[model samples]
Target: MTAGNVVLGLCSYTHDSAAALLVDNVLVGFAEEERLTGDKHTAAFPERAVNWLLDTAGVDPHSVGLVAYNFDGRRYLDALAATEMYAGRDTTRDRAQPRAESFRKVHDRFGSRMADLRDRFRRARVVPVLHHRAHGLYSFASSSYDAAAVLVVDSLGEVQTTTLGSGRRLAGGGCRTTIVEDIADPASLGYAYGAVTEHLGWRRGDEEGTVMALAALGDPTRFRALLREAIPITDGGFSLDPRWFPLRVLAHDYPRVSAGFIAATCPARDPSAQVEAVHADLAAALQERTEQVMVHLARRVRSVTGLRLLCLGGGVAANCVAVGKIVEAGIFDEVHVPPAAGDSGTAIGAALAASLDNTRHLATGVTGRCYLGPAYPRLVLAENPRPGLTAHRPAAPAKHVAMKLAEGHTVGVFSGNLEAGPRALGNRSILASPLLPDVVERLNDTVKFREPFRPFAPVVLASAMADYFTLPQPAPYMSIASGVTDLTRERIPAIVHVNGTARVQTVTADANPFLTEVLTEFAALTGHPVLINTSLNVKGKPICGTPDMALDCLTESGLDALMLEGWWVSKC
Candidate 1:
């Protein structure tokens, strides 16, 4: 296998498909397919993402030397689809196509359906990585630890849903991951959470965050006994009770809970049905139970590896509440959860694992980076304003933004690079004063069009974060949900949830220069450094990625103004 200078990483054939490029083993660009395709958690091959990354970075397609795909199982699965298409019949029923013909079809299909992508890699060697291993690799490689325990959990990754391992940077350069334990499906803690999400009458993959928000409002004790019995903590690791859940995950099946479990608990609620106190209580129970399992897993990893630091990745790791619980448990001195901790981030993992002869595994301790996607310079944005809008160049952009927020006007910000993850750090965020009494209601009803129960996050100044929240560590990525102080609840009530906790994203001058200035100015004006920061997108849509997309959002949504690079825009 040739480890070449330019390695392109891809995560596809699953939701949140993305493309990441590594020039000389250095991560140059990363973007999700959803961002450009405007489909939330889209599973389509990231054609637009790849094109955007390549074009924005000015990398020639022919120059790419290696293609690293995150999912290894796709090789076997793609062949089945090819065989069916080759014979023009269901391969499972016919069983007539030969192995050679099937492989030939795979080869031909790559040259046709993926013609452009295949031709772009005419001189490149393609490699596949195991899904769980990639998740483990990303969290470890991106962390600042010399060596740390790694925990990766999701609904399912190829086969295993959870993996425990240790990672350490090599003395010479690149990093290495050593696997300790693997937990397969149906028994997965992540699937258990997803099952609960489905049972709560919400979309499993998309609305799990909503359920998490609902957990903050409910009584966990109501279903505490049932959940403890369903997912009891084991000596090695926790396992889901088969009596409560289906043995396997059936595609397109809602509420994969067993009949016995349904009879014991409650019937599955419809998506359109109103969420009641019982549903919230069940959500609270599921979240609490899930946190116990995570803490147990972390303790096991610590005992096995004797490492003080932990790096977490995958879908379950997206649960900031569980992350906060693990942090409070003190299993690790520091827990590193990247801005993009889910499957889309596996693209970065795949590239980091592959090394080139010339580059010494490009230094990718991107602990300070969230703005790492497509960026439009001031020059790129057309000075000519769009129809029905007026544009102006402010003397002090940050102060102007602060002034608008102080007046209770919600401002959409489109500046610098697009954030690589789900959270809108600042560059692509809708900012409002968290001090406003009805800010949440206004944003939910007019702009976001989201569920009222789902609370917005606060982008707080890093130096001021400790003054308000009981966070164990700095959360620049909004990856941990920590309890809010009384001062916070009194001052910035809009961002605080019923649980007296807030998902906070701390910002510093080094992390985001513009946002740092904006926060400083806002604090000076309102005597509060916090702002309600939500992703710059309408509900059910991906975050805005380009100037045109940002403009489209400003026009379609209830944003009072937009702070684009070098220009202030408002509807006439």
Candidate 2:
């Protein structure tokens, strides 16, 4: 069958399930199931997201050339068996027989699901791409560099937990990727990191960022020896000592491994209370060790590939702190981490891999911004105004919002399409003046209801990024953290973390014009072109998706006003 211009991508039955529509190899629509369903890190099938993308793109599902799924269940079974054997689990004929039969049934069920998708789509063929390969493809394809060493490190992807590869743009306009190494299951840095997160009394995958934040408050030297024993950095790869963390029976059972590690290393304590100094030190050590291993990996990749550009994906790539360390090391001239570096981005990678030959016309370089979700009409806000709020359609919404932010009002800005990944990136974001230190406490206590240690990101005008943070280039997506300059630390205390760093998102006029305008106006008012930006949602909820969700966030949270598309609504 000839590959057509349209392809649909789906990622489900794993965390951060999402769907994407690629028309003629150009991504037209994308969204996570969590946003549409109001479920955080949903693993359920993204049927609603798929339907929404199809409707938004005005493409008939039946006409899609291919439906790419970011999983291979067969590989999963192989990895599970390997993990059991590595852990010294009884895998003799007597024990392996029933497991083999059960695996066959599960594999057959996965095959049937793919067949069902094919039947439902009628003319479309369903293709399954290996999870880490999908992540590598997305990282390489979405990057601006023509060739780069790709690294994918996640908790688990099929049988492999980490992949090192290379991607290059073909002279013929397509892209090719080759895997150089694969770190199989049970020796996963991602899982190790998740285990530390669990040990710190945070949800593994969901709260790893919180652990990263808390790391800033502790001294890594305190637990350096313990962490070194847990995860040893090898020559070309890293090893998670099985003694420290046994091979997990289930991928998400990180708490078990975490409990074991904590029991072996630290003093006994209550699990539900605030983090103690030891917990912070452990977090620090884990974070430091992760950065060391990542930098070592990057250096090895560069040495092997001789490529100056590096592209990273997978759950571990979401560690802006580690990314910053990699950049500071100067192992690679440039590094690109896609906005949706996590599993949600595998949808795009699967679509790209399946539609490789069809992507000649797709825009080259970085793919610009990630505002690929649904966009609400301005009329919707006008027609449905919430109570005790006055809606005003100003001549210049950006300027009005900028003035409010200058006055220290926290504003929820919901504009254009929602972002595809975790970071808010102006759209579906809460904005405030970064100069006021109290703003962080306010946002933590009232708006986000998150831990005080969780630092906010700064959305700075791209042109002005160098003035604030010492960065080589613009971080269009909040994918990396950079040290705040001493001036910046003093000027924008709200966004600066205890370690004097900020997860910075630099916006260009071409990518986010409204946000640029708002920053431009804000600069004119406050002599700074930066704002404290956090996702526009309460704690434990997915970022706001629609106008109604934005309204609800505004009313429930401490946001002073909300900018929905072009309509501004202020609480009375």
Candidate 3:
């Protein structure tokens, strides 16, 4: 944990592009490009993100010695090659591109922007970490566990669909991740679910969570057998039948489904069409299959690795329902999923991987994580004050915010450093009283401007989770859903879903003292230590990253109040 040159990590040119910086084996800063660009899930190179991290950490680019990229450039070309084979085209068609065509592809000589890193900073060495390897490293380095079975399931990562690995701490405070088994492409459960998402009439990557929520309203048994047949279970994982998910027709720009799928089930839904009961049933069936396969995969990893702890990452791990099922199955003694489990998190993973290689130890993990982004040490209102809003500083902002929430007001809170991933995590979140009636309805329809079917989660005090939700452990990142107690269901109807489960986020004082105090004060006033929590942004937009953006959202959305740093603001 002592010495390493400054390392920069990049996960760009794909979904959720981001950058992370490590200095002396410690991750000092990380940010997703989508948060700064105003475009949701932009794949642009994260130049601004890297600059911001370097500036925030006060690190000079000239001093950086290594650059870690989250994808083996050659292996990724192989992944792209499968796309050609899947499309039934000659794999050699794009192998030898002309100089100009190849110029667009290469950023440096070592593969994938290594030259660019050197050009931008100095002559830093660029290393291409395998995509799934970065994910496994991130899980192992970030968790408190010394040894764990790691599972990474995503759409595809350099030909790997699902990876089963084991990670253990080395003698010198370092960690090692070893792949025990992996399921490669052509039989991807991630693609199977993505195909199902597109067929359900929603955007594949952007709207899978909506499908997860819609599943709560449907009957899983209606189409369970059909999907089970389409995706047969294997020894450790599952495989998607080529008949149901023809590679030529799967995950492409158009014709999202195969002819066999149309013959076996109905055609893909139109985007503007209604969410009919059949669609709901299909989503439920798909979700059930995903949960079963994930649980099966975790169980197999536990068996093969003989490890009591599990660390899960990748885009598919973002499914809270499936994650909860894995935990409920008790396949391991503990399960840890990073806050940013998706592609954006690869930046951190890549950096940690390099740090382990550079210094033989991971210096940052097990504590002080997820809130490593930019912060407003000063209130943002005074910089670019928005009209029609009255603001004042309060000595006890948490107490004052709790008072407003107790009065059934929807308040948007923006404080501390930004949470690194998709989940808002209280630092950038909207809060509402869960005991109030129609709070969820108004939050969905008016405040968030989202589908009514979408559900809100409860941010409860950590010690109070057992009193409300039937969770076996603390859910610090809102990554898992658990059963709501009978008393909780009756009292906080706003947070309870149709399936009688709530995605609960348990808060501790160290994570966010103000939110913890607010929840504590709200409990003192309302007798319930819970509030409806969701991202502090409208649908189809990334969460606000700057004070100006937060102020704009405060004016545009139907929120009743605002917590701008330590000040409370409301529309005049």
**Candidate 1 local lDDT, residue 506:** 90
Poorest 10 consecutive residues of model 1 by lDDT? 91-100
Q: Of 1 and 2, which scores higher on TM-score?
A: 2
Q: Model 2: residues >4 Å from true position, as ranges?
A: 1-3, 80-109, 251-255, 258-260, 267-272, 357-366, 382-384
Name every residue pair that clashes in candidate 1: none
lDDT of 1 by residue, 1-572 (tens): 23366778888766799988877556788898888777889878888988887786677777777777776654433334444443453312232255334444444553443444466588777766778877888788777788999999887775577888898877767666888988765468878888888888888887789999999889999999999988988887887775676554234533368777778667888988888998999999999999889999999999988999999999898898899999989888999998789989998877776542235553463545667788777444444478878888889999999999999899999989888778899999999999887899999989998788889999999999888899878898888988988898777778888877788999989989999999999999999899999999998788998788888899888899899886899888
- Tens digits of per-residue lDDT, candidate 3, 376-483, equal 876545523678888888888999999999998999999998888889999999999988888878998889998899999999999888989888887888999888
Assess the local accuracy of residue 426 in candidate 2 as a C-alpha lDDT between 0 and 100: 88
lDDT by residue (436-551, candidate 2, tens digit) is: 75888899999998888888899999888888999786798899889888779667777888887889999998889999999999999999999998999998899988777788
Which candidate number has the best lDDT? Answer: 2
Report the lDDT of model 3 for residue 328: 88
> lDDT of candidate 2 vs native?
0.82
Candidate 3, superposed: residue stretches over 4 Å from native: 1-4, 77-112, 248-251, 365-368
User: How well does each candidate superpose onto the true structure, as a TM-score?
Assistant: 0.90, 0.93, 0.93
Candidates ranked by TM-score = 2, 3, 1
User: Model 1 misses residue 479 by how many Å?
Assistant: 0.6
Q: By the lDDT metric, which is better: model 1 or model 3?
A: 3
Clashing pairs in 2: none
